[model samples]
Target chain A: MQKTTSSISNNISFTRGVPALEALPTTLFSECLQAVLAGPDGKTVLQYGHNGGYVPLKQLLAEQYHVDVDQVLIGNGSLHLQDMLTAQLVQTGDVVFTEQPSYDRAIKTFRRRGAKVIGIPLALDGVDITALEEALARYTPRFMYIVPDFQNPAGVTTSREKRQALAQLAEKHGFYLVEDVPYRTLRYSGKTLPLLRELNPERTITVSSYSKLISPGIRVGYLIGPRDIVKPLIALAEDTTLAPVLPTQAAVLEFHKRGYFERNLESLKQLYAPRLQAMISAIKTYLPGIDFAEPEGGFFVSITLPQESNYQHLLQRAKEQGLLLTDGNGFFADHLNAQANQAHTGDRFVRLPFCALTPQEIEAGMQRLAELVRA
Target chain B: MQKTTSSISNNISFTRGVPALEALPTTLFSECLQAVLAGPDGKTVLQYGHNGGYVPLKQLLAEQYHVDVDQVLIGNGSLHLQDMLTAQLVQTGDVVFTEQPSYDRAIKTFRRRGAKVIGIPLALDGVDITALEEALARYTPRFMYIVPDFQNPAGVTTSREKRQALAQLAEKHGFYLVEDVPYRTLRYSGKTLPLLRELNPERTITVSSYSKLISPGIRVGYLIGPRDIVKPLIALAEDTTLAPVLPTQAAVLEFHKRGYFERNLESLKQLYAPRLQAMISAIKTYLPGIDFAEPEGGFFVSITLPQESNYQHLLQRAKEQGLLLTDGNGFFADHLNAQANQAHTGDRFVRLPFCALTPQEIEAGMQRLAELVRA
Candidate 1:
C-alpha cells in the first residue's frame, strides 16, 4: 500500500531504507511453533507470558554474559525500553549526549520528549568521550545513550579504557547509562569483550534482542537496570503493550533451549564475515575519497563522504542501476543545517548496508555506486 | 541463574510468569525465519519492517475484515498503539471516556498521558450510552476506549445500533474514537455484529491482535484508521519496535493463507465454548449476589460482586488455593481514587478469564470463587 506522509516522512524512507526481512531462523521458528502447538493451546498464548522474556532465552543470555539474571528485563524491544528510559529520566530540555551522527530514531525520541541533544563527533573509536566527560561535568546529562558494540552507521566499538572510563564517569556522576547492544551477538570478529553491564550493572541499562540473531518480526528485545528504575519502565510497559505475546516467547524459549540460537549465530557469522570483508575491500578499491570505519563485528559500516545535497538523487541513480542505499540525511538528528544549506552539497554521505547483500551483490552494488559517483 | 527480587524469599519461583516459549507456533515461524536466513540478514531485521506490520499479515487481516489494505496500521499490540495514539492526540488534562471498569492497561495509558479520564458505567450491552452521551455533551473528550465483543473485565460488546450511534456521535462531536477490539474475533457466540470502523473509519482507531486468536507472545496487533492519522502512527511505529518479528509474521501469514486461521478459531470455540458456559453457569448458580455479564465469546466474563471489599481481600485466599486473579483495582483510568485517599475501591468487581481451563476446571474454579464470596 502507498503510505502518504507529512514533514516526518522526509526523515524516513520505508520503501528504500528498510531492507527485506533477511536471514531469519524460519526452520527453528517453525520447529518451535510445532512444539508449542503439540502441547496445549489454552495456557500458551491466552494466559500472561513472562514479565521478562522466555526463561531459557534469559538464562542463555545470562550464561553468555556471565551475569546474574536480575540484571535483565526483556521488553517488546530495545526501543520500547528506550522509550521507558527516556520517560523516567529525561526531563524536557535535559541534555542527552550522543554521537553527532547516531541512530536518528534515538535522536528523534529524545527530541520528541523535549531533550536538548548534545552531539559529539563519531570518532574511529566511538563518540568523543572528551566531549562526553565535559558534558557530564557541565550539562549533567540525564543519561548518555550509545550503541557501544558495532554502533549504527559509525560501526565503531569503544576502546576498553573508554568503557572503563565511561563507567567510572557514570559512577561519579549520578546519571544512568543506557548501553544498547542490539548488534553485540552478531559478531563477525572472533574476539569479544565484557559488556558494559559486566563492569557495572547498577547504573547501566543494557538492552539487546533476538531480532538480529533470530528474527526481528517477533518484536523481541530486553533491558536490564536498577529495580526502582525498571519498575517505572515495567509500569510504562504495562501501559503500552500490557505484555509481550506469550506464544512467540514460548517459541523463542524452545528455539534457545533446543540449541537453535548458538548454531544459527555461527551460521550467520560465517555467512556475514565475507560480505563485510567484501564491502571493506571494495570501499578501499573504489570509493577512495570517503573515510569510514569497517566494524570488526555487526551489520553496519560508516563513511564520511564530501558533503553534498540531494541524497535522494544519488539514491534514485543507484536504484535505477538495481542497487539500494540509505540517504545519510535520513540519519541526522537535525535536518536543517544553515551550514548544510548548499544544494547538491548539503547531503554529505549515505549508509551502504553490505551485510544485507551477498559478496556478489555487494560488489555489484558498490560498482553501480562507483559509476554513480563518477557520473 | 537465580534472579534476585525484593519479593524474592530464599525460596525461588523464578518460573512463575515465564512463558513456555516452546508453546508458540515454531513450524510456521521457521518458514518465515528460513526466508530471513539463507537470504539477506540485514534486510531481514535491520532494514525497516512495515509500520503497520508484515504486509502479508496485514493483507490477511484485510481479507478477514473485507476491507482495503490501507485501513490497517499494525502495532506491537493494542497497548502499544494506545501509547502512540495518546502521544499523538492527547495533551495534559484532556478528557477521555472509557468504561467505568475496563481494561486497566488502557486506563493507565491515557492517565499517563495526563488525560482527565471520565469512566462511564459498563454493562453486558456495552458501556452505558446515556452516561457516555452526557459526558460527551459536558466535556471535550479526545477519544473513547471500548472493547465491543467479549471485552476485558466486563466481557461486553456494543450492539450494532450502539456502534453506529457511537460513530455518529463521534462525527457530530469531532472527537476521535479509539476502538480496541483484540478480543473481537474471540467471541464465544456464533454471531457478532458490525464494528465502529464500519460506521466511521476516518474517526476510528481499530486495534486487534493475534494474541488471543493465534498467540500473545508473538506480540502482534494492528490499528486501522485514516491515512492522515495512520501515517504519523507509522512514523511513530518506526521508533518503536521497528517492526514486528518476521518469523511470527511469516508463520501467521502462512496460517492465514493455508486456511489454518479459521480452523484454529473454530476448534477453539468448540473447545472453550463449553468451558465458558460451565464457568458462567457455576458463577450464577453458586454465587447468589454477584452481578456479571455472560459473555457470548472470548476468554473472559466480567463479574461485579455484591457490595463489599471482601472480593478484594479474597485474592490471597484464592492464591492459597492455587488460583490467581486480577482485581477491579487494575481496570480503572486512575488506579487511585483521588476522591478517597486510598487505592480505588471500585474494588467490588473482578474479571474472570475462562478460556484457559477445561469445563471441569472451570466448574472447580467457579466453585472455589463461590465459596470465597459466600465466606
Candidate 2:
C-alpha cells in the first residue's frame, strides 16, 4: 500500500475494555476546542497546565458545591480521581467495598491497586444497607466506594435514607466513603439525594466531572473531600495528567457560568431520553425475557438475559453486526482471579448505552441484537 | 460565600492545575472541534481509537525513531503512561533511579507506589554516567528514567556516547530503560544524540507527546516499546484514563495528516528561539552569581543559585512583582528523604522557562528575579 500519512507505526493490539465511541457526544469535537479558543486570553488552553484545576472552572465548580476553594481537586475525569483516591486510600489485601455491579471501572481501579473489593448488592433505592452493614461488620473495608447518583453498570439510584445510612456506616466503621458521582446532575425525575459528602462532610470524598454534564473529551472533573484526602489526590493529579485539559475546563466553566450548562444538559436529555426509550422498547418487543432496570437518567441500562443464554457470545456477535456493548464480566473486581471468577461469575448481564446514539440507531442496534438472539 | 449554582459544592482548598490553553495552536483547535461535531458513524474514526497509539501519529513518531509499529503503546500523555508503566513494572521496594534533580512530579508518582528511588547526579552530557553506573551496580533500579532530549528541570541532553553506554548498561544489567523524550523535538540549536530507544531496541521504552508540538489540552501522547510490554501498558491504560481523549486524538490526527505539525513546529521555532536567547541574556546580565548550563534547546534552564539563597522567598517576591518560577525542590523523587537532599537540594536550582514567555516578559521576569535575589 502507498505510504499514506495515516501510519499506525506500532502494532497496537486492542484492549478488551475500550467502549464503543459511536455514541459519544458529537458536538464535543468542537466544544472542547472552541471553549479554549474563546477563553479570556484566547490561548489554546493546552500548555503545561496548572497543577490545580482550571482557575475559573474550579471557581465555577466551587460555586456549585457551596464549598470552600480548598475542598475540591479536579482531575482528568472522575476516572482519574477514582484511581488516585483508591491508590492513596487502599493498600494491598486491604478490604474495600463498592455497590455490586457498580461502576466496574472503579472496581478495576481499586482491584488493580491490590485492594480486595467487596460488592454490596444494589437495591431499588440504593445499595443494600443491610449488605453494607454486613460488609462493614465482617470485612471492615478501608473505604467504601459508591456512585450514589444513577450509578454505572447497575444504573440504580440510592435513596436519601440509604445514602444517609451509608454515610453513618462510614462514620461508625471509621472507613471513608469514596463517592463517584459523575451522574449527579442527570436526574430525569424525583428529588436528588444529597451527596454522601453533603450528608456527612467528614466521611465522604465526592468525585464528579464535566464528562456527563458537558463533554468527556475535555476530560475535566473534580474530587471533593476533606483536606487530608485531597492532598494525596492532588499529588496523584500532579503525577497523572498534571491537571485536566485546561481548554475544556475554561470553556466548561465559561459555559456553566453563562447559563449554558442548562441548555446543553437540556439538549442532552432531549437527545438521550428518546434513545433510552427506544432501546427499552426494542428490548420489550424483541426479547421480553431479558430482565433490566431502566435508569432514572444516565448513559446505560443493565440487562439480565435468560440464564440459558450466553451473553458473552452474544456480545461478540453484537459487535460483529456493528453494535457495541460493555460486557458484564470485566466489571468484577476479582475477574482476574480464577476462584473469584468461579464464585462470582455470571454471563446473563450486559450494559447498553444510548447516550451517543440517536433513538433510531438504538432501535436498530437493539433489533439486530434481537435477531441474533432469536437465531 | 454565596450558595451559587456556578461553583463546586465543597470548599475545596487545592488549586486547579493550569489549563492547556496558554500554549496550544489555535487553527488546529478549531479543526479538531469540527471533527467532533461530526457524529460517530459505523465506519467513523470514533468507533474506538487505536489501543496503543493513534495510527498516523504513532507512525510519524516511529519513523522518526526508525522503529517498527510493534514497539509503541499510546496513551493519555507521557504523564499517564509514566504512572501506568511504573505501576506495572515497579513494586514495593523496587529501586527507581532518576536524575539527581529530575521531574519531581514523576518522582513523587513512583514513590506513591512505594518505589525506592536513587537519584544520580546530572551533568552537561546528561546523567553522570560514572555515578549512574555506580548506582546501577548498587541499586539495580527496576527502570532508569531519563529525559534524553531537553529534560524537564535541567534542560540537558545526554551525549551520544553516554546514550549508547546507558543503553548497553541496561542490557548488561537486565533492566528496562525509559527515555522520556517529550522535549526531543523542541530544539533551539544544539545537537541531540540518538534517543535511548534507538540505542537499545529491546530494553528501551520511548515516551513522547504533542504537548510540546501542538497542545497539552488535547492530552494526547504515546509510549513506544516491545509489544509484550505494550500489552500490559494498554491493560493499565484500561484502568487509567480509559483512553486518550478521542476528539483530541482525531483533531491531532487530522492536523498531522494535513501537515499541520510540520508547519506549526517551524513556526514555533520562530516564536521560541528569540525568547530563549532573551532569557539566557537576561540571566547573564541580572543574576550574575547564579550560573547554569545554557540549554541548547527546549523550554527550561536549571539555574543554580547559592545554597544559602531562599528560592521560595525569592519566588514570592517575584510573584509580587509579577513573575513566577517553579521551585527547584519539586524535581526530587526523595524530597522526604534527607539524603536525596544532598543532590542540589534547596534554594540551589530553579527551572526557568522562556518558551511560553515573550522576550519582554522573559526580560521582565528575569529582572524581577535579579532584584529579589540581590535584595
Candidate 3:
C-alpha cells in the first residue's frame, strides 16, 4: 500500500483524532513531570514498574472508574491493551464481531491476529441488535468489539437498551464483550449512561485511554475487567513491553492528584464545543445535499455523499484545495471475512474530525470540501 | 504461578537490572523534557507521532547506527520491539532458538507467540557455535534470538569471531539473526565488536534499548533491519501501540542533542566498574568454592553453586538475611522444546546484579549470600 498525505504548503487536516495542539497543557505537564521527578516516589517513577502498572495510578483509576485496583491493567496505550487482549484470547481463525465501519486500526489489529472479523450493520442508536443476536447465535464469536461511546467514523452512541441487550447476549452465548470507550467522558450534549463493563461485570472488558482527555504523547491507557480475565493480560503485558513507561504513568497520577485532570477536561470541553458547532454550521451552509448526523461529542462527523459521487475522487480533489479528510473505505473490512456483504457501505462516506482544527479552519475546510463535491 | 519478591527490612537487592536510583540523571532528564516542551517541536512532541517513531528521532538513530532511516523502527521498549518482530515473523508451532540461559522475559515473549523455543548451550565466549550449527542443521528455525553484548544473566559478551560466524550461519541457513544489544554501550573494559546487523545486513535484525543507558522509565528502544523486515514491524507497531510515547521520544532526541547521553555513559561506567570489582572481590573473599567467570562489564555476575546444593533453600535463607538475588532457574526455558536437556543447566546458577546497589551493600549482600550457600 502507498502512503497518502494531503499537505500543500499549509493544509487544514480534518483527518486527525488528536486534541488541539495549541490548547495542549504543555506547561502544566512539564510542571507535573518536574514535581514527579523531585517527589518522594522519584526512584519508583524512574525505575522499571510492576508488570500490571504503577500501583498508585491503578488505584486512582480504580477509584475514578468504580472498580477494584486488581481489575485495572495500564498499558502503553489503549490500542496496546486491545492488542494484548487479542493476543491472549484469540486463536487463529477465531470468529470476532465488530460494528460496520468501526475503527479502522482496531479492525486491522483483529484481522492481524488471524481473526475472521464479521461486521454487524449499525442502526440509528447503535449496532443492530437483531443482527448482533443472529451473528452471536450462528458464529459463536470469541468476542464482540464495540465502540459504545461516540463510535468512531460514525459518531453514533449505543442506546441504554441496546447496551443492556448486548451484555445479556454475550452472557447467553458464552462470549466476551469488549467495549472501547475512549470518548466516554466527552459528552457535550447528552446524558452519560452506565458503561458496558458495569452492566456485565462478569463477561465485559472495558478499554479506555487518557489520550483524548489529556495528551496523546504520554501514551497511557487502561483496561478494566474481571480479575480472571485481567490476570492473563497482565502476563501478556509483561511479555509485551515489560511495563508501561513509568514516568508517564507517574506524571498522569500527579496530574490527577493535583486535580488538573478534571479541571483540564472541563477546559477541553469548552475549547472543542465551539469548533464542533462551527463544523455543523458550515456543513449546513455549504453542503446542503450531503447526509450526516450532528455529533453530540467526540472528534468525528461522518458524511455520506450521493451514490454516484466518488469519495476517492472527492478526497483527492479536496486535498488539492488544502482540505484533508479520511475516505471511509479505510474504516471497513476488506471482504476477506464472513461479513463480506457488509463491507461496502463506506464507499461514499468520509470521516471529518473537528477537535484538531480551529473553528475558522473547519469552516474554510468544509467550504472547500463542498466545492469539491459540487465539481 | 506465585509472585516473587526480594525484600525485607534493610534489604539490599542484587536482583534488579535497573540503574542505581540515586545516580540517575534525573536533573538532566527534567531539563531536557522542559526544553522539548518549550522548543519549536513542543506541539509536535505532545501530539500523536508516526507509527514507526518520531521522524527526526529515527533519522538521528539511523545516522548513529549507520543504517537507512527506513530500516529503523522504534517501539515502547526493546521487549516491545522483540514481541512485534515475533508477531511479524513466527507462526504457531514455528521453531525458534535462544541461548541456554537467556533473558527470561524474552523467552516468555517468544513462547507467548506459540513458537517452540530451543536453547543452545553457552560456552565461555558465547553460545556454542558447534551446537548452534547442529541445531540449525536439524531444524529450520524461524529466528535465533541472542544477547551478544554482555549477555544477561551470564555476563558473557560474544567473541568477535563467534559474532561473525553466527551472522554467516544465519545467512547460510536462510534464517534471521535477532541480536539484542541492550548493554552494548555499557562496556567498561572490553573492546567493542561490530554489530551483527552490520556484518549481515540482509539477514540480521538488531534490537537495542536506551533503558540501560538512559533510564527505564522513558521506555524508548529501536530495531534495525532491512526495509522489508522493518516495514511489517512498523505496521505492527501501529497496531500494537499506535506509536511510542511521543514526548519520551522527543525528550530522548533532546538529550542526545544536548550531549548528555554520551557523557552520562562515561559517568555510569565510572560508577559501575568499582561496584563490579567489589562484588567480585566479595565473592572471592567470602565464598571459596563457587565457580564464576569474572565479567568485563554489564550488571550481572552469575555464580554456579555446588551440584548437591538446593538453590531454592539458599534463596529462602538469603531472603531471611535481607539479601536479594535472582535464581538462575528463572532464565531457562521450561523444557517444552527440542533442547529439553539444556534447560536444566540453569538449576545450579544464580545471578547477582552489581549495578543497582552500592559497593558497601554489594559487599554485605554477598557476605550474607555466601553464608546461606555454606549453610
TM-score of each: 0.83, 0.81, 0.92
> What tens digits encode model 1's per-residue C-alpha lDDT throughout B1-375?
112122222221111212223333445444444444334442444334665676767787788776778767776666777788888888888999887677777787888878988777765687777867887778969988888877776777777878888888889999888887877776767687888887887888788777777667666677888878877878777766566655556556666766767877776677777878987787777675566777787767767666553565677776666556675666765445422523224565656776655555555666666666663
Best by TM-score: 3
Please provide, for model 3 over B1-375, each residue's C-alpha lDDT reduced to its tens digit, 9 standing for 90 to 100.
Answer: 111223223888878688887667888888888898888888787788885988889999999889899999988889889987998899999999998788988998898888998888776688889988888878988999888887888887888999899888988889998999988888889688898888898989999988888888788999999899998889778767886788888888988999998989999999999999998898888777666767788888877777565565666777777877676676876454323553245656778888988887787777677667663
Better of 2 and 3 by TM-score: 3
- Candidate 2: regions farther than 4 A off: A1-32, A184-194, A212-214, A254-261, A278-294, A305-327, A331-345, A350-375, B1-24, B35-50, B257-260, B278-292, B303-347, B356-375
Angstrom error at residue B355, model 2: 3.3
Q: Rank the candidates by DockQ, best first.
A: 3, 2, 1
Which is the leading candidate under DockQ? 3
Q: Residue A239, candidate 2: how far off, in angstroms?
A: 3.3
* Interface RMSD (Å), every candidate: 5.5, 4.2, 1.1
Q: Write the per-residue lDDT of candidate 2 for residues A164-273, one digit (tens) a residue.
A: 89888888889898888777677766677788888888988888877667655556768888888886667667666664566556766666656767877777666667
Per-candidate TM-score, chain A: 0.85, 0.83, 0.93
